[model samples]
Target: MKYISKNIVFSVLVLSFFGISSLNAQNDNSKIEQLIEKKRNYNQTEVKSKGYIIQLYNGNETKAYAVQQKFDEMFPAYTSKMKVDLPDWKVQIINFKTRLAADRALNLFREEFVGANIPKS
Candidate 1:
């Protein structure tokens, strides 16, 4: 009878330990899920508007197109764009995501395009 009682007490203690550990695990999972949801909401509302561009030419439309064409031929890997800012038609290499990337491209461009520069923003 004493052995049976001792076995029962030990069984209860082991079961209670596992039960408490499981409850703590479930609580940890809930906290982790809440953190993930908050991160998702933050990402959804974030607006990314930082980057750099190198302007190759700023002149008339005819010269802008000519510069863009020449730039396209020289640096086929990079994408070029033209923008009309009032009196000047600007030819630019768009979407350099970092200053280092823009500077590297600018160095290469200066070898061929004398006017290649990153415009002040």
Candidate 2:
């Protein structure tokens, strides 16, 4: 009889714990939802702007083309283009609106290239 009563008491304690946790979970979810709504409202007034790009390479047409292809394979997310201006071939990443944003990218590219510069657009 004592064994049965102890089992029953344990079961009730476990059930109460789960019930209390579920209530707390619901409250947490409501708070998360409210925060998300607030963030969405704040982002509605966000502004958009333009920046500069980092020049990766500049040399012969064939060499620049190969470098551009390799760079594209390495960083597919960035816009890498090759242009011919006079005697040199230009490989540049364009449209970096902010100096801070451009500098962040410049630091990453500096590991691979020595001539990475954030030129204005």
Candidate 3:
């Protein structure tokens, strides 16, 4: 009877050990999921501010898309946007608030397309 009790106790301990470990594993997975969600939200969220616009195109949808794609390929760090401003398909680069910043970005852009300009914004 004492030997049977010891075997039963050992079985319970082994089962409890696995049960507690599985619970802790579940808690760890929840924490990891929450961290991943926080990181994903940070990357998707955008904050707005006043800035300059560097005009690259003012007409022709096909030509504007081509230019936008080319700009994106060359400067993946900077965002290139295309919009319809009625009577024209507009392509522009945004977020350069200062003349020096705009000029510096323009210099890089000019290396590929010499005609890129930062109009009054």
Candidate 4:
């Protein structure tokens, strides 16, 4: 009877130790998860990088603006910008994060703007 009680006590202590440790582990995991979420939010809000840009039109200012207006009407989801470089004016959709994303945009734009492409940089 004494030996059985001692074994039961030992088992209970071991189980309690593991249970406490598991609780601590869960707390640690929650802290880690919070930190990761914070970092993700910070990255989204603070970091800004110029990724891929697809040039839709490259010619004179008048034609570039015309293309920009047409593009705005066609792809309202995307934003376009006009840049003046020397004698040429460029109308582009900017801030694509990956080549795959740019390629997808290119495919969509290609249906309307035949000259749409992702320029090599």
Candidate 4: where is the Cα deviation over 4 Å? 1-49
Cα RMSD (Å) between model 2 and the true structure? 8.4
lDDT of 2 by residue, 84-119 (tens): 897999999887766678899999988887787865
- Model 3 lDDT tens row, 85-115: 7779888999887667988888888887766
How far does residue 20 in candidate 4 sit from its true spot (Å)? 56
Cα shift from native, residue 100, model 4 (Å): 0.1
Error of 2 at 18 (Å): 61
What's the lDDT of the predicted structure labeled candidate 1? 0.91
lDDT, each prediction: 0.91, 0.84, 0.84, 0.91
State the weakest 10-residue window (summed lDDT) of model 1: 42-51
Candidate 2, poorest ten consecutive residues by summed lDDT: 43-52
| TM-score per candidate | 0.59, 0.55, 0.56, 0.58
Residue by residue across 1-121, what tens digits does model 4's lDDT show? 9999999999999999999999999999999999999988986786445688999988998989999999999899999999899799999999899777999999999998999878776
TM-score of 1: 0.59
| Model 2: per-residue Cα lDDT at residue 12 | 100
In model 2, the runs with Cα more than 4 Å from the true position are: 1-50
